[model samples]
Target: MQIPTAAASGRSRLLTSGVALAALSLLLTLHAVPSAADDDTPARGTASMGSGVLAHEGVHGQPAATDRTTQTEGVDVSSHQGEVAWSTLWNSGVKWAYVKATEGTYYRNPYHAQQYNGAYDVGMIRGAYHFATPDTAGGAAQADYFVDRGGAWSKDGRTLPGVLDIEYNPYGDTCYGMTHSQMVGWIRDFLDRYKARTGRNAVIYTSTNWWQQCTGDYSGFASTTPLWIARYASTVGPLPAGWTFHTMWQYTSTGPVVGDHDKFNGALDRVKALAEG
Candidate 1:
C-alpha cells in the first residue's frame, strides 16, 4: 500500500532519497523484523496455514524475524482493516500500537475512532498517533493539527507521547527536497505545542537519514522523550551518534496484520509505562 509523505522532494516516491535507498538495509537490521526462519508466533487456538505460518489479516507470518512485529510495532490496529483486530493482536502478543490519527493539510485517519475504540476494548496501552506534516505547513499550525487529531493527550488514559511522521510529500519538489534542519524544526514545533497543551515532552519518530544528515543536538530534549527509530532491519549497524535510547522500532515491511493490512511497524517495550504516565 502507498503510505503518505511528509517531505517535498519533488518525487512521487522517495526511491532516490538516500534515506529511501537505505531503507531496506535499515529494516533488515531491526532486531525483531521478520525473516526466513521463525515463521510465526505460536498462538493457542488460531488456525495456522498449511505453510506452518500463521494467517493474519491477508499476509502470513514468516519464521525468520528480528524483533518488531507487524501487529505491535506501528500505529493503531486501524492501519489494518476488514479483519479481526483486537482478538488477533491480543493473541499475537502486541505490546503497543500507534494509531495514525491525522495526515497533512486536511486528512484524519478514517479508522482513528474505531481503532482507538478497539485498542480501548482490548486494553492495549501505550498508544500514540502520527501526523503527516508538510515541510511547507510551518511549525505552529502543524503542531496544533497534531494535537487536534492526536486524540486526548491526557484524557484517553494518557498517550505514550506524540510522533511526527517526517518523510516526503509535504514539501513536494521544493528547492532542495527536505533538509535535516527542516525535520528537526518540524519535531521542535510539534513538541513545543504538545508540551504547552499537555505539559509533557513529545517523542520524535525519524529515519536514520533524517537523524544522521540533519540532527546534531538531542541533548536539549528530555531523556524521557525517547526516540522512535524507523529502520526495517535485523541489526541497526550502530546507534547513530547523539541518541541515547529509542522507544519503538519500525523494523520490517514484510508484516502480517489482521484486517485492512498493517504496514510498517516496530517494537514498543516502554509503551505501556509511557502512555500511562
Candidate 2:
C-alpha cells in the first residue's frame, strides 16, 4: 500500500508524537523489525485503535501513540526499522531480538538475512517471527513457508526459536473468517508443524482481546506454548485461558533501540535458556 507522506513539518510532529507516546506508555503502563523486498512487502497496515496503540500502527499513515518506559531485554523489528545498529543495540543492553522474516505464505523480509545474522554476530540471542495470514492460507502451509524463510533455526544457544505473530490480521477479517474452533485448529496446525519441523514449539505473540475474540480465548496452548503477551498496561491483566503468566511482555512501541521494546520476564540466564532448545 502506498502511504502518502505528509509535509515535512507535519510528518516530523506526527512521528515525534508517535515516538514519545510509545516511550511514555512504558513509564506509565509499560509497554511494549525488518527489511523485506519490494514485491514482497505487505500493504502498510494499521492496528485497530482502542485502549493502546499497536506497535505496528503509525508509520503507514500517521504516527501512533506508543507506550514508553525503560528496561529492555528484547525487542522485535521489521522492515520499518530500516538499517539497525546491532552492535549499538547490544551495547545498550538489548540481549535478544525477534525479527520479522515472513508473512502469510510468500512475503519474506529481504532484510531477514541482515538483521537475523547481524544480531547473532554481536552475540545477541536472535529469533525470527512469521506474521500469520490465516485468511490467505491454511496454518500448515503458512508454517512451512515461514520455516523455509525465517523460521529455520539452529541449536546454537544464542539462537531463539521461531515465533508466531498471531494478533491482528493486517489484510482483513481479524479472525480470518474462521470460527473459534476453526481458529484453534488453524493455530494448532501452525504450532504442531513448527514443532515437528524444528523440534521446538513456536512462541506465541498476541493480545488478550485478539485471542479471545478470534480464538474464543483458548487456553489449551498454555500448557505447552510460551506466551508473549502484548499489552500497554501497568499489569498484563487477564490473559488467555491457558497461560498463567506471560513469558514475555511487550511494553512499548518505541525505545532507545530501533524497534518495539520488550521484556523477557526473567533474567539473562532465563533468556539464554529460552534461546536454547
- Best-performing candidate as measured by lDDT: 2
Per-residue lDDT for 1-277 in model 2, tens only? 8665678679889899999998887777542122355344337322211112263332211112342433337878887776789999998888899988888876888777889989889988889998887888899998999998878878889888898888876555667788999999999999999999999999998888888888999889998899988876555567888788788887667567578777887778888888776
Deviation in Å, model 1, residue 98 alpha carbon: 0.8
Predictions: Cα RMSD each? 19.6, 17.4
How do the residues 1-277 of candidate 1 rate in per-residue lDDT, one tens digit apiece? 8565666444645557767768877776775656645654422212111111112112433322554443244333333342336757766765455666665546566666777667667766635455444444665676677677754477455356666654323223321255656656666776777788777677665555544554543345545466665554463334445666555555444446543122223334345456656
Each model's TM-score, in the order given?
0.62, 0.76
Candidate 2 runs further than 4 Å off: 1-72
Please state the error at residue 206 of candidate 2 in Å.
Answer: 0.4
Alpha-carbon runs more than 4 Å astray in model 1:
1-84, 155-158, 169-182, 214-224, 258-269
Least lDDT summed over 10 consecutive residues: which range in candidate 2? Answer: 44-53
**lDDT minimum window of 10 residues, candidate 1:** 47-56
* Candidate no. 2 TM-score: 0.76
